[model samples]
Target chain A: GQQVMQIPQYQHVQEGEDFTTYCNSSTTLSNIQWYKQRPGGHPVFLIQLVKSGEVKKQKRLTFQFGEAKKNSSLHITATQTTDVGTYFCAGPPHRFNKFYFGSGTKLNVKP
Target chain B: EAGVAQSPRYKIIEKRQSVAFWCNPISGHATLYWYQQILGQGPKLLIQFQNNGVVDDSQLPKDRFSAERLKGVDSTLKIQPAKLEDSAVYLCASRRVRRDGNYNEQFFGPGTRLTVL
Candidate 1:
């Protein structure tokens, strides 16, 4: 069975500190997506990486995809209270439309 | 634009009791998905529907779980004789289909949390 694994199941950081979560897949993927879920809220789409070795940034967040398309990472600089949430990386198994989600990394930002 | 919609934000039932969840995807979206998210975990795909047809349900427990999307719009998921392990949040998501095989972002609805005792 194919699986997406995320490391650092739980991370607590000071508001001004940096944080990162890594996602690795058992099989190569055609594309990968990142999502965030605030406590008690639904998961919201944040970004997607399609090309191998792609790197995209959104404000303080930086996303990177492995050259082999088997891993990805999300890094947040200067974490804020609003950054408290669970981050998940999802990838399809050689297809589009269906996804296998990572176990997710829960982040707790303390001020 | 309106987001996906789910009913009965929360549910509580004893083991062996039957339960059903309803979901309405965004307008004009042709792909809908049902997922189960246990506390502290990510959402797991239970079933996926491309319009009125099922694309994949390999992960669904066929003996106890069933889903339908008759009009290719709103959908429902039912679990009969539920077990204590069935406790989790059910999330419904939708996305527009692209002909170019490009992946699209999924819009999720506020999930229905189920607590089985």
Candidate 2:
């Protein structure tokens, strides 16, 4: 079984603060995908990073993959109220068939 | 284009009863998956289908949970003799299984929240 662990199980920030969540896995991943789920809502796909040491961005959100492909990080700059949710990173569950999700980092945006 | 569709946004059943969930994947996608999310946890894969065929069901509780994707279209997940711990959100997702593509994002449905008494 593969394990993907996320840190900072909970985070609270003001309307214009910043936040970051880190993900680590016991096994090397061929690819890693990030998702966000609002309170009481299903997960929505955010972005995917495949190459080792790769970095991608969506406006204020930046995603990075470790050089060994065993870890990842998602950083939010000047977070907004819309950024409130739990962020999860997923990889193929067993040798690339299904997917396994991280416990997630719950972000609360304050006004 | 319509997103993945799931029915009966919420359900409450007693233990030992049977319940079923339906999912309609995004148009033209070939891969579908079923996941269960307990309160305060991430989604866990119950099963995955590759166009009407089972790709993975290793994590599914075979004795109580079952899933099918007949004809590679709408899929259903059933939990017979439901247990009290079966209370959770059942999510369905679909993606285009790539043969030569690099990105095949899995689009998830609104999910069916089930509660067992």
Candidate 3:
């Protein structure tokens, strides 16, 4: 019953363009976490990925992990306007500790 | 090192009335969580604790919700007759348990924004 799906639930982009968001998972994940909720604020913990196909960066923001760890991705380059908000992707369900969230990806950035 | 601490950041009962929310976590951290966020989706675990027992609540909503975290620390969550979809926002998170047992990175508070009218 593990699920974590995310897509372009919403995205605007303009400040400079460039944004990406995608996460998938139905089962299979030992690690995967990323969050950011700005607008009203609350969910903030930005990176975490464990091996598999790992790829992490946090300046212009870039994160990927999927070699069968289910799936994950987050990219944002030129975007600015503080980068707007919403973007979540959590996981857990291999050994399980209870975590499953991913129905976010709202980014707006429009200056 | 003080983070997760929720309260009545905002609330507006109505439907059936009855509310309760409070949390304090982030001292030695023993894992505590409770989420609901429903405006757009994401953040939905209803219950989880590890120190005061209860490791999962299967998504809570036990007839109308309920929670507690006695001696292990502080915690509370109640709903009673509330309805109107129960409104949203009610986050409280805390995590720290990594002596190899793994699992850290949660710290989230400033939530509680119910508005059931």
Candidate 4:
């Protein structure tokens, strides 16, 4: 079975500070996706990384895929209060159709 | 466009009782999934369906949990003699078919939060 491990199970930062979370998988993945879930809300798709050593950005947030395709990271520059939520990384273990989600990093941005 | 839909945004039940949840994916989406999220944890995959056939359910507990996607449009998850540990938020998600073979973009519903005492 494929599994993903996320570092810093919880993160709290002052407004305007930076935050980062890393995700590593046990097996090689075809691609990796990121998601965000607000308190008591369902997860919303954030972005997906396909190519090896790929990097993408959205406003102040940046997503990177490790060259090995088995690791990924999400970094938020100058975090804000709206950035409070749990971030998750997901990828298919094999062709089995089940995507394993990382334990997740819960962010609490204080203003 | 309408997003995934789930019935009974919240539910409360006693242990040993039975409960059921329903999900209606976005129109024309062929893939459906169910996940359970405990407090302070990420969502765990419970089942996956491609149309009317199941693609993976290796994580489902057959002894007390069961799910079916009849007609490949709507799905149902049922738990009999539920235990207190069954309390969690159940999320339903759907993805549009991708010929490129990439299915990382999935839309999730508001989720049905269950509390079993």
Q: Against the true structure, what is model 2's DockQ?
A: 0.81
Tell me the tens digit of each residue's lDDT in model 1 across B13-81: 999999999999999999999999999889999999999999999999999999999999999999998
Relative to the unseen true structure, what is the C-alpha lDDT of residue B45 in candidate 3, on a scale of 0 to 100? 93
* Residues B47-107, model 2: lDDT tens digits: 9998999989989999999999989999999999899999999999999878864546899
TM-scores, chain A, per candidate: 0.97, 0.95, 0.34, 0.96
Give the per-residue Cα lDDT of candidate 2 at A92: 66
Which ten residues in a row are the worst by lDDT in model 2 chain B? B96-105
**Candidate 1: residue A70 lDDT (0-100):** 96
User: What is the C-alpha lDDT profile of model 3 across B3-76, one tens digit per residue?
Assistant: 88889889899989899999999898888999999898998999999889999899898999999999878899
Residues A1-111, candidate 3, lDDT per residue (tens digit)? 677889989989899999999999988888899989998888899988987899999999999999999998999999999879999989787897788889999999889
Q: Would you list the clashing residue pairs of candidate 3?
A: none
For model 2 the local lDDT of residue B6 reads 100
- The best candidate by DockQ is 4
lDDT of 4 by residue, B10-93 (tens): 999999999999999999999999999999888899999999999889889999999999999999999998999999999999
- Identify the runs in model 3 with alpha carbons over 4 angstroms from their true place: A1-14, A17-53, A56-61, A65-73, A80-85, A102-108, B1-13, B17-35, B38-41, B46-57, B65-80, B83-85, B89-115
Query: In candidate 1, residue B43 scores what lDDT?
Result: 97
Docking class of 1: high
TM-score of candidate 1 versus the correct structure, residues matched by position: 0.98
Question: Against the true structure, what is each candidate's TM-score?
Answer: 0.98, 0.97, 0.35, 0.98
- lDDT of each model, Cα atoms only? 0.95, 0.92, 0.90, 0.93
Report the candidate with higher TM-score, 3 versus 4. 4
Classified by CAPRI criteria, candidate 4 counts as high
